[model samples]
Target chain A: MDLIESYKEDLRLIRRFGTGFWIVLLLIGLILLPWFAREYWVYVVTLIFIYSIGIQGQNILIGYTGQISFGQAGFLAIGAFTYGHLSLLGSPILVNLFFSGLMAGIFGILVGFPSLRLKGPYLAIVTLGFGIAVYQVFVNSEILSGGRMGLTIQKLQPLFGLSQMTTYYYFNFILVFLFTLLSYNLISSFVGRAFIAIRDNDIAAEAMGVSLTRYKLLSFAISSFYTGVQGGLYALLMGYLEPNMFTFLETITIFVAVIIGGLASVEGSILGAAFVVMVPQVFSNTKAFIPVIYGVTILIILIFEPLGLSGRWMKIRLYLRMWPFR
Target chain B: MPLLEIKDISISFGGIMALSGISLQVQEEKIIAVIGPNGSGKTTLFNCLTGIYHPNEGEIHLNGENILRLSPDAIAELGIARTFQNLRLFMNMNVLDNLLVGRHLHFRKNPLLPMLRIRKEEILHRKIIEEIIDFLDLQAYRKARVADCPYGVQKRVELGRALALEPKLLLLDEPISGLTSEEKEEAAYRINEIRGRFQMTILLVEHDLRIASRLADSMVAFYYGQKIAQGTPEEVQRNPEVIRAYLGDD
Candidate 1:
């Protein structure tokens, strides 16, 4: 049996030293992966890291805050374009990334205004409209987004005598790590509780002193910020920006990641991102059947593992902990 | 000055008046039971006071401040906490988290501090929550999700949530409506202990007259959106209109 000696122990993210050791070992493996793996696999893993950041953002809005958003691609485009434009203007890489997230977060607040009075499908439609509008604007605005021709970004200056690819990989790895840590901290606090409370029962949440307007907008802003950062990373990785890149299909892919990863979980986001990224690679030879495979996998997960892969992992861990007994 | 003063408060839905010109005064540290038949606007008054519904006319003063203009959360911050007729506990959260949510207002609002795992403030709040858990005798279910809890235990968790706010005025709508006799007795005893231990002013809406009159310092009776009687429990029980409201006129 688990015994929590204090509230601090109860609040710990990694409760046991064994878990911490394993996590550290896993992180070390991830850090050294680029040296041993082929460049193609390294590239795929980098894309997974970027998508993981965005998926965590979606999880916060849909999973933790109970807000349905289908316009995450809009925020992604905003981040990508912001990063591209800022980098072209000779801004520092860090500053460009920060502005990318900040710009998307500002628009997130704008989308959140409609959510004050709307819920469920109505809110989803509004966000979907937002995603389409963003795509159209980028496609039409020649000066802003290069108008269908797309923008190209220069590679980063290699750091610590590492190869350019490894540098980019490390940049993404550090960011995903920091963002995951931040999400974990945010989820365990009073703000996180307030978000859950609003999700479960909004009226009671208001009565309990949680301002609906403030927290709802805050959820949107934070979620979009994460997606925006991912967009910046994506732009850096691809070295190209096109309006068609941030399509409605991309938003749905991110949503599927949240569902398959498990809602309100950090590890779920990472696992979900890896699953989505790897599945397409697995079916690369028969690209036409990718969608069908995804559908079947999702159906199976929903039917048998409703809590998703993370939940299933947890159950397996519990069973092993109670081995030799049914 | 009275702790809470309701002056000619009236609310209407379409054409139906839920409450009309209902006025009353509640002094500090007193239990005032509002005993009324169903559809008599007892819950309506609680909603208006908590700022869930905007009254078309009249004023509500808490600690001598006009509260009609404040939003529900603003009123909550002004030290008014309530429990719903139907339990509104965060169903997915554990009991400990539910009580911690009650202390939402008390926790600092800096998003960055908690994100860094700042334990000083959280530990302080947890101490208060532990005391509430002890008071409510919810140790066994402390980590259990609110949805998994038994009905009677859920009721105590609801009460514990309200108490966690440490409000000056506590509004309880039907605190013991659905419970076994033994649970009811335990709840009544706890309700009495709440007033004394917390030194809080309670505005309770209970249908059981025996428990209501036993625990209340005074009683108010409502009928058809108007106050029919207001006085000592025995005095309100003796009022002819209150008698007619409960039983058919003969």
Candidate 2:
């Protein structure tokens, strides 16, 4: 009985701390996995990190501010290309990634400024148009985008002095950590509150002295900037760039990731990114109808778990421990 | 000097005229109420004064300068604050933070400064924080979320948020309309105390004749977007146009 009571109390601590506890535990497991799990899982893990960066950007715009952008894949393409092209020209990896992210953000600002005047579906259409335009440019521009042939990037000079699969995993993990922290800090701050305020009521936000147009435009631009930077990192990790890599469906995935992970949540982005990137890859070897299976699974999750898997887990944990109170 | 003056202001929403030519003035440290029947453009006139709507004709001078062209944000910076007819509290935010946001014009810290203000201006003791919390009696429920509060509390909280701006002129849209008798009385007490405490030049739009007469020093009555009467509460209440236009009977 004493041992069982101790065991239950330990489980309770883990349940209460929830996402942070799980993420930290997962990070530890991931850091150790490269030693035992071999090459393929490492690749899949790297993919998860890269996807989280994309989701992080989406989280900023869609989750926090309640703005939808169909141009997300376009922003992703900009990051990938900027990084791939700069790296090809003999620039260092860090310099290329930083500049690429910066350029993508500026691009976001330009597009966001004029089109943001229209709300909701109109704004989504404008961003979709931007995606289509970028797609056209990517297909036609042989010199810049390498046309349909795609650009094969052989190497990226690592984030720090670290190397090998384990090092790469840690590096990507840290990047994801930083992204989550930045997002958390942003949400907790006046700017984040302002975004929620704007989302809640634009008229009231303005009456309360928030500049609606300015902040709306800035939120889009900033969200894109974060996504763009992630794109550059992604190109480096994949060791290639292709027009097909960023599709409209992928933009949908960005939204799906947040919604499924738990919209307006940092941990939700990570969980969504992981599920989106991993589940498909894990079944990729099955070859015949693996992608179809993944799609069905996602639909099931959407139907029954509107708050997403993370939200469901949170409720279950609460139910188990504090049942009567709940 | 008069705190606010609206000259022959007019607004047409597409083909329909919402507010026809209307004019009114509010003196410093006085409670001036605007009473009207529904669709008489009471809210429209308030919207124009607060820069939510731009009048097609004439100008509104705030503190002796035309504020007709100013945006809502610009009007706020010029020391004008307002409460919506429907409460628009940042429901997710804590009660104190809602008021703190109203002190936006005073905040030079940008968004970054609020984090640093605790250390940077250790001496300021967060002046607005202390004063607003005290003035509105929001001390007990400072940390409570606005969404969870009762309606009467939310109403008071909205007023507290507006007063946080420490504005020279406050445009209150029916501050006591939907409240029960007790709540209305509480709001009336706060209105009197606020006026006495802050020396605020209040422009109140209300439908309740009793509350208006008891609280307001003067009243401006509107009919079909036009000012029909303006004088002391008793004088305007006596005006036949006001009686027929807003009072409907008696």
Candidate 3:
């Protein structure tokens, strides 16, 4: 009985302290990373953070609610443009970020109307078309895209006591952390439960009093908000805005991150974003094989761990904890 | 006034009439069992009443308010809850989570609270879920995913979910057709208990005569999308049309 009680306590401890401990340790690692790593590596890590934020939004849509959007880059473009214009106008960085997300979220609500009546491949087509259309509109607009010559802010304000790169990196990190916490909260709440119910069996969800149109649009708006914020961060990091940045392939990369990370798992988005962002660096010398390597890695992940890296990580952790006994 | 009144409700699929001019009136706090053979329009009637299908003609009234044009969730919000014939529990979610979805209508819209880990409303609602779990004897299996649970457990979870709505009326679609004898008895007991405890009306669809006769306050029989007979259990069970539909003329 005493042994059983001790085992139970151990399980409780693991449940309570496990996530917080890892998060703190990871934060420490990230803070120390730039000090030891080169400038290029710091830039790559910043990109990873931005991508992770976008992928978290994708996870909410595709993973939690089982909705698909192939035009995520459309929202991202809207965010990036909003941020670029606001920053050029000498607005505070925080205000720029907030409005960037606000603009993208409004667009998300517009797109969400079609999603109410569409599903599967039909929805995917609409989103795909939407992404390309936004890209074309931005590319052709002289004021927005600077007539294909692109736009740039003369200077970006950095937080005091930090270098430009360091400030941006930390800013991205802070936003990622805040948004991850937000996603976790939403997932465990009534709104999140309703999304899963709609995903699993919509008729039952409706029968139980979940409004189909309301939640569908809500998920779209919320996910777009996250993507829009990430877009602002991306524009700030790049210091330049180009219509090409919001291409169809960009949206595909975000989708890949969500799938490879684990649909519906918050940590999966981070892992997937990191992998998509950094893996290209490893094959920088082998430009011809980049797509090949990317394809092969995704195929393997899908076959062996359909739930993505998060699922594999859980299995590994469980195995390590019960090692030799199992 | 009757708690629910279905008047001249008709529905068709590709010109094939599923329910043709069928009507029903359910009194407040009384159990009404709908018994019919397969393809006899029992589920179609429920679907029309719940807004899963729009009747080609006629009206549905809940407490004197016309609800035919309302969406399913809107109907549910106006104090209606239902279970499915095929056990439509969210297969990806655990039993507790499935039941939590049942409380969707009760939650105040606060999307940001859970992110901050606030639990004021969640804690309150969870207490209600706990009560439901105990009432359904789902304590042992609350953590189990519905996809992995046994059929009998899934059926109970579905019922528990509808109960969580705290609706004025409960629509149970074949609640005990697939259960073991013991499970059936348990379900029968719960049905009787629910009527007394909640003082809520029930529209039960059952193929089992024994369970229907034992539990229902009144019984209605249907044949080919039209009402054949309705009265006490004995009256319907002895009706020639219901007998011919079920047992066939020999």
Location of the lowest summed lDDT over 10 successive residues in candidate 1 chain B: B111-120
Better of 1 and 3 by DockQ: 1
Stretches > 4 Å off in candidate 2: A1-33, A157-163, A285-305, A320-325, B109-127, B130-145, B247-250
TM values, all candidates: 0.98, 0.88, 0.96
| lDDT tens digits, residue span A1-326, model 2 | 12323322422312344556776887788778777886778878887887887787788788777777788888888988998888888888778878877878888887777544777888888888997788778878888787677997756445555556656687677777677666765665567667887777777777878777777877887788788888888887878898888887777767667777876777778889888787566666775564465467668877888667677877887797787887
Each candidate's B-chain TM-score, in sequence, is 0.99, 0.91, 0.98
Q: Which ten residues in a row have the lowest lDDT in candidate 3 chain B?
A: B110-119
In candidate 1, which residue ranges exceed 4 Å CA deviation?
none
Backbone clash pairs for candidate 1 read: none
Model 1, span A175-285: residue lDDT tens? 999999999899899989999999999999999999999999999999999999999999989998998899887887888899899887888989999998998898899
Rank order (by DockQ, best first): 1, 3, 2
Cα-based lDDT for every prediction: 0.93, 0.78, 0.89
Q: Per-residue lDDT for B1-250 in model 2, tens only?
A: 7788878889999887888878777889999888888988889988888888888998899889989998888888887889999898888788866776676556554655432322233224245565767766677787799999888788888898788778889889989978899889878888988888988989899988898889999888888877888888999989999878855666
Candidate 1's error at B105, in angstroms? 0.3
lDDT of 1 at A73: 89
Location of the lowest summed lDDT over 10 successive residues in candidate 1 chain A: A288-297
